[model samples]
Target: MKQLVIAEKPSVASDLARVLHAKEKKKHYYEGKSTIVTWGYGHLLTLKMPEDYKKEWKTWSMDTLPMLPKQFLIQPLPKTKGQLQAIRQLCQRKDIKEVVIATDAGREGELVARWILQYVRYKGPVKRLWISSQTDKAIKEGFAHLKPAKMYDDLFYSAQARSEADWLIGLNVSRALTIQYGDQLSAGRVQTPTLALVRKREKEIESFRPKEQFTVELSYQGHPLTSRKPLVFSKKETAEKVKAQLQKETAVVKEKKVKVKKQWAPLLYDLTELQQVANQRYGFSAKKTLNLVQSLYEHHKIVSYPRTDSKYLPTDLESSMKERLQAVAKEFSLSGTILQKGKVQQRKVFNDQKVSDHYGLIPTEVAPNISRLSQDEWKIYQLITKRFLNLFYPPYEAEEQTFVILLGDQNFQLKQEKVLEQGWKEKEEGVSSLHLSLNQELPIQIKVVSSMTKPKSRLTEGQLLAQMEKHHLGTPATRAEIIEKLVNIQYLERQGREFIVTPKGKQLLTLVNESLVRPELTEEWELHLQKIEKGKEKKEQFIQKMKKEATRLVTEIKQSEKEYKDFALTTKKCPECSGRLREKKTKQGVFYVCSNPECHYKRRKDLKVSNHRCPQCHKKMVIVEGEKGAYFKCQSCSLTEKIPDKKAKKQKMTKQEERRLMKKYSEKAPAENPFASALENFQVQD
Candidate 1:
């Protein structure tokens, strides 16, 4: 009997099929003599929505604030229903005696496969194919030594707990706030706290008061020497006095200290670090960087798993270091040198206990074709390759020197750094030059500088990701998505490289309970989830605690005296309900919605005047938002044209020329046209 293998994504399933020799590709499954491979499109199922449980839960009301389900259910995603059905049929095939779960080797991956199995009621014997990369060698080895599906039960439990907890807390709180405030506002266990962090930083920036201070500096030779302790005098007179006294005296060298330090290379890229670096260097948002790296890992098959949190490799992977190094040696000179050396130094990067689901992101045995990669993909691949190559290189060596000089009653200090060896930083090291000798006294020049204290800079995407990592807000895989969600929901705005909290976001935070806006709650939940994964904690206990917390949060919010103001009002009136339209921000940009609670009128705020002129009116057509989709409408003759699914072909006209033509046509038009009489009658009515 043949075995059925299910992978997480089509790309991965194709890779598995190629390696397993399942060449005959059917509609949804690939068949071979011994096996059949099918795939899911990421997640085929998700936790059931509140409305899915019962009809009463459909309405947003305070009475149904805490809609806790005794048993959470899974529903097939609308877009993937066909794929799920195909998998079910494949699983129930009589010839398929055993099923293989070949999804990603992670918690969410386990949940993806298990939920399908539970829904399909698959009772066949099961095995799991766990591998880090999609390389042919790794796939072959992984299939040869497939593990039992029972081993990942705890992981599945943890995944389910996380999904259900988010649903309970996020949906319940969102409904409670929306009902209380008469606007659609959302709050989540992780997203709310992250928003609070940004708002907190903004508050700090707003309340910051700058104070002017003065400091004296002495120029010895060409180097400026400042006080060892930064002496910021509040009074400029005091600094002037010190500078004047120091200018009359000659400086004497008091002491000199020198130390040689070796700076080791940075650890390998976990998803967070990689996102951080990419944001800082290329101005790529966290989501953009994640997408780029994910493409490199999945589509190019060049990098290892991109969603790993561990920055260390498993000890067993050390056996393939030579092969990995050889793969990149053609592109990187450091790789060639390392291969020539024939000995990789054992560093902190190789730790068995530290590795959880996958090792650090690295290059696989498949050599990358640089010409085939996009610009962003090439840059990210280079980053990973450089980090991996740096592992085998020596540490950066530098001579750090500190000089102390006595001038009057004050002591001045100067530090200089000299690079003795470039080491791993050969291409990136900066140049430094300083001439100093011990026991040399030189003439001194003094200057007093005044400056004002500056507030802390706003958090960049990179800095925010680092903060999220530090606070354990979300996993590496989810942090980028969380940041994008915040931006989409109008809680955070990206101005250049910094994240600024919106006024609406601040109001939302003020209304939410304090516990819900703090990272401690999320961090505590993460700790419990980790314990659950390790079989040290029960999933039921975690759910029970979350239910109580959710109840308390709802009660606190309902009882609070806080008020929410409608700050997003727009001048446009809703065409359907004649209600006042309010501006709303989403991930896809801004839109306008009706203020009436029951009204479902909404439209995109962006409107473009298309070049396609109305046939009857002979006027420029404007793209108007409609119930179905966008359509071209003429304001003069009321003529409408349906926009094509593809790009509409039209003649280009300058705005000035169009405006002139519009004026010319409106002032003097052909009276013989049938629409002209209607237009004249409409104008007379106006």
Candidate 2:
């Protein structure tokens, strides 16, 4: 009898098929000599939507706000019913004796496979194939030593608990707020914490007080030596007094200390870390980066697993390091010196204990041939491949010398030059280049004088991050995500790399319950979750606490009398009633809707254009905000267009003017897609 293996996605199933010799591929299944591989697309089954339980819960009403069920029910997603059915058929096959859960090796992955098995009531013996990297060798080894699925029962239970809890809190609270506030305000465990973080940062940015300081410097032979500024007082009068006193004297030679420092190659990219780096350097959002990385992992097959939190690898895969390194070296033609460095496998980059579900993203053993991949896929693939090669090479070591001089009672300092070792960083190309040295010594033309006061070091994002790292609000893996979430939710805005708060975000912080928004809450939760993973803490206990906290929060919200004001920019009142018109977001785009519950009046604000002309009637178009984003619509014709800004409508445009511009720019020739008009009301009512 053959062993049946199930993977999370078709890409993974295909990879496993190749490894298990599963050559015959079906639409939803793959057959091999000794294995049958089937796959799921993310999730095949999820907790039933509220409307699935009862009809009345379909509409947003305070009456149905906390729609928590006595027991959770799993139902196949409408789009994935065929796939789920195929898996169920495969499970019932008489020849398939032992089933292998070959899905993702993480909590979500475990849940994905288990839910399908439970939903279908698969009653066969079960085993688990756990492997991070999807190399043929790793897959082969994993199959050879498959463990009983019962070993992961606790993990499954934990995942289930989280799912149910998220459903209970997220769905209930989201519905509650939407009903109470009378808007489509969706919130979830991840999104809420994310929003709170943003609001907090925005608040900080709003209250920030910028101050000015002064510094003095001295000149050495052909080199500029700068002094560190010391502010004697926070008052402007004292600052001016110090500046005047400093002008009376010149700088003098004081003391000099210089040393060499080594900069190690960065650990390999995990998904979150990669997202952070891409966001900082390329301005790509986390979701965009995740989508890109997923393509590289599944479609390109150039990068290792992307949905990883670990920045390290397992020691068992250590033996394959040389071949993998050599493979990347041959493909990228990295520095000859790096390839010759004798594939040094260091524990610093590979430790099994540190890696949970997936190891850090790395290059696959297969050589990356980018001919089939799109430009974006190639870019993401290159990032992973280059980072993998850099890890094996030696650190980018640097040697530096410092010269210090003092004038009067103040001290000044200067650096001579930067010298690079150029080992691992050599392989990095394009945007992947290392930012080794920014303070390079320049030739200065001035005579040596008395030492001056030292200058203050300005804070960079990197520097502020160093401080955040010390505080330990989040791990290196999650810091970027935390920061990005804040920005996306309008809690924080970037002034260069510095974060600035926004008013709405500030108001959110002042209005929401403080304990729910505190960073320590998540920090503590993380610590406990880690313990639960290690079996040091009971998952049930942790969940009970979370439930208790959630209930208390809900109760508090219900009792609280905090007032919320609508931040609408539209002047038009509801056509159906006297209620004010406000922006209501739909999947299609934003539209003006009546705030009154009884009045459901809405307008498309149709500013969408096609080929610079409105789609409805041929004319030039003007851009307007909709639920989805921004779009150009005909001003003359009663036509609308859709735009792509995911954030809600900006406050500038008025409703009537927006609608007028959209009609004026309507396309003279109509487009074939008739649903464009229907999309304004296309929200999934549930």
Candidate 3:
């Protein structure tokens, strides 16, 4: 009897198959001497919806404000029905005596595979293949030390608790909010808290008061320098007084201080972190980057775990770094660089303690074709590839320097520095890290001819984002999406890429309680989750507390008439039914819809891609939801394809031009008919 190994996705399954020498492919499974490898598309099963359990809860009504079931139900998604049936059949097959769970190493991944096993009622002995990257070496090693599936019972339980809690709180809260507000408002643990952060930031930006400041500057020893402390002057008289004092005074150097600092390379790029960086740098959406990374992992089979949260590899992975690095160097054309410059390998990218479920995203040994990927895919791929290469290089070294010029009483000080050695910086060659190392002490010879005290500019959104990233509130993966949501919901607006909160955003914070939307809430939860992962806290007790808190929050919302309408706008009438069109919140973004049930017309503010035209019915396609993301279906021809955002498509078309083209193409006229012939006939004889 052969052992069957199932993975979360085809790429991983194929990698395992190759490592196991399962070259003989049959249907979805790869058959080897002693193993058979197969894969699932993310998940083959999921929790049943409210209506699935009971049909009465389908309609939105205040009476069903807090619909809580005694026990949750599990069911296969409609699309995964066939896959589930196949997996069940495979489980019962006599030849497949043992099963292996080769899914992701995270809580969610554990839940995904375990739930299916429970639903199928597979009684066979189970094994778990926990590997970070799909590199051949990693896969071979993972197979050598596959652990018993029962070892992850606690992790599975934790994953289930999270899912159930989200359902309990999300469903109840969503229903209550929607029924009370008479809008299609849905809330969840992740999405709601994320929204709250955006709303809070918006409030701070709106209420922020800018204070004008004045400072004195002086020229000494041919180098201009300003006062280290900025003097905030409430009145122009104070500014004039300070300016007059420094006008005739020669600057004195109080003391000269110089310090040398050593900087290490940044941690490896995880999926979310990579997504955030690409979004901030190239204006690619979070969803866009996710899709690109998925392609890099699946279609290209060139990147490891794209949905991972960890930026560091585990201890087990460290032993294989040389082989992994060598593979990457060969594939990415960096062998010469590595040989000439030597490795800058550091502990930052390979620490075992930092990893929770899986290590950072890295490309598999499988080579990536640069030509096959789209422009956005190439951009994201380059980011991952470059970071991977840089991780193997040496640490960055720089000598920082400080200079202080003394003349009379007034003091002047300045600093400058240069790289002592490229070190790890040379791995990605000239690629710059997020933050440049800056401090006093290490000094470089500088010939400064001019310097002046100028008005300090307001912080850019990029700078704020960089600061937030350093603090680690949201992962690299979710930051872009969070920012985009704020802008979409009118919580923030773009002044070139800089984010500033709007009035609506500010008002949203006041409408919601501070406890529900503060950064500290997320920080607290993160701390607890980390503790739970380390087995320092009990999952059941933590979940019980969450349930209590959720219950309390629900009760409070029901009693208070906090007036959410104060933030929601109702300025325009619905075009379809002449009813007041109110602001309705959704995961996609905000929308304006008809209040009347009879006339259903709504316009989404968020962007969606155009679908293919129906060949039979000659109508534009509609966006269809898929397991992974959204897709497009042609209503006329029944043609279906994955839908990517138009913004990421790198297309240029004005609204008028798009509408004209759509109308022309969607017309009832046959393709054979020539518009030129008709125009010629209508023209004058001359």
* Strongest candidate by TM-score: 1
Residue 5's lDDT within candidate 2 is 89
Task: Please list the residue runs of candidate 2 whose C-alpha ends up more than 4 Å from where it truly belongs after superposition.
Answer: 25-27, 50-68, 221-258, 335-337, 345-347, 395-399, 404-406, 409-411, 417-422, 425-511, 569-571, 576-579, 585-588, 596-601, 611-686
- Per-model TM-score, in order, reads 0.88, 0.75, 0.72
lDDT on C-alpha atoms for all candidate structures? 0.87, 0.67, 0.66
Q: Per-residue CA lDDT of candidate 2, range 47-107, in tens?
A: 9999988899897666665565656799999899999999889888889998899987777
- Choose 1 or 2, whichever is better by TM-score: 1
Q: Sort by lDDT, best first.
A: 1, 2, 3
Candidate 1 per-residue C-alpha lDDT over 1-686 given as tens digits, one digit per residue, 9 for 90 to 100: 99899999998888888888899999998999998999988889999998989888997778877999999999999999999899889887889989999988888899989999999999989999888888888889998999999998899999999998999899988888888887889999899999887887888999999999998766765677877587569999999887777778778778889999998877788989999999999999989988998888888889998889988998788788888888888887544467976454538888889898988999999988888899999999999988888888778898988888877677788777888887778655444466667677768777888999999999999998888888889888889999999888888899999999888888999999899898888988988998999999999999999999899999998998887887898677888888889997665657888898779987778766789999996889989977798899998888888998665666589899999999987895557877877776774443
**What's the lDDT for residue 282 in model 2?**
68
**Residue 264 CA error for candidate 2 (Å)?**
3.1
